[model samples]
Target: MQNVFSEENIKIISQIDNWQKAVEIACQPLLEEKKITQKYVTNIIKSVKKYGPYMVLTDYFALMHAKPGEGVNQLAMSLLVVKEPIDLEGKKVKIFLILACPDSKSHIKTLKEVAGVLMDQCNFELILKGTKSQIIDLFQKKEMDGGKK
Candidate 1:
């Protein structure tokens, strides 16, 4: 499989002022790469407002996304690791995964791959504290290991 993440697609930040800011920052890499439009970012915030932190998939983690064509240019993913946890509604989140897919079907495999990797508690903790390269390496290793630990 191709690499789902690149150096340009990841970021490590110490903190964010709020969940909204966190979302924006998390989407920055994809935004800069033209994988998604500003409208995509706005749509995500709007969705969260309407749905109430539904993207916070689990404690300390979030997978922020909007429907395909809200402004997507391609299928891509971005990562933002906040060294200091930020609040999303009542939940605290440290990792944000911003996904932009041109169509509904394209993201399914990548989503499963990511979820499979993070499903391991050990992988989740390492990713939460990992450097950009470390995170990329972990993901690649997991993929090579057939998504095993």
Candidate 2:
């Protein structure tokens, strides 16, 4: 199994003033890689504002994204975590997994791998405190382990 995460696709932000900025910051890696544009980030925030905090995956985690095919150049992702939680309306989020994809189907495998980690508290905690390389290594190790329990 191969890891989708790398040093270039991850960020650990110390703080953010708002959820909109958080989504923008989380998508920065994708932006830098030319995988997505600023418009994609704006659409994501717009969707969240219209729909509410339905994307918050867990207590402190969120999956930030918009519908594919908007400004996505390819399937790519980034991880963003903050030192403290920020308000997304009523919910608080400190971790973000932002994704941009070439098509609707391309990111399923990626989401599956991410969901595997999200299901394991131990793994998620490691992600919370881990450095960029440590975070990438965790995903690689999990992939090599075949996501074993």
Candidate 3:
């Protein structure tokens, strides 16, 4: 809900040629802000090649990331909704949730909240169909609800 993504870190790409490009585009906000180095994106692609896209957490969703300290400048996150799905072997990824965590302990809470959003079909659908501003507002709503009294 509350993350780097909440503050102009969201991207709505029409399509990408490959998953690697998807990762790169998703990391753009973090890269622009210097929250992560180019090496971070490289490392993440390498990890996916060697280990596979375990990040494809569920239907129409994928969570992209590198290990903590692998070019991380801070604990921040970015989200990219690719209008055209990314094919990972056979899995299709429409949402790319990228996170740059300063260290191991800093990412869990944010990751959990993000995973929650992805797990809900309605929420995920909203992301797929929403405009850039609507997408931002969707997460903002989640953030506000997260802090309920």
**lDDT top scorer:** 1
In model 2, what is the error at residue 114, expressed in angstroms?
A: 1.4
Q: Global CA lDDT of candidate 3, please?
A: 0.81
- Name the lDDT value of residue 2 in candidate 1: 52
Please give the TM-score that candidate 2 achieves against the real structure. 0.92
Worst 10 residues of 1 by lDDT: 140-149
What's the true lDDT of residue 84 in model 3?
90
TM-score against native, each model: 0.94, 0.92, 0.91
**Can you list the residue pairs that collide in candidate 1?**
none
Q: What residue pairs clash in candidate 2, if any at all?
A: none
User: All models: lDDT?
Assistant: 0.88, 0.84, 0.81
Q: Model 2, 8: alpha-carbon shift in Å?
A: 1.4
Q: What is the lDDT for 1 in model 2? A: 36
In model 2, which regions exceed 4 Å deviation? 147-149
**Residue 141 error for model 1, in Å?**
1.7
Q: lDDT per residue, candidate 1, 68-130, as tens digits?
A: 977999998888999999989888999999988898798888789889888989889988987
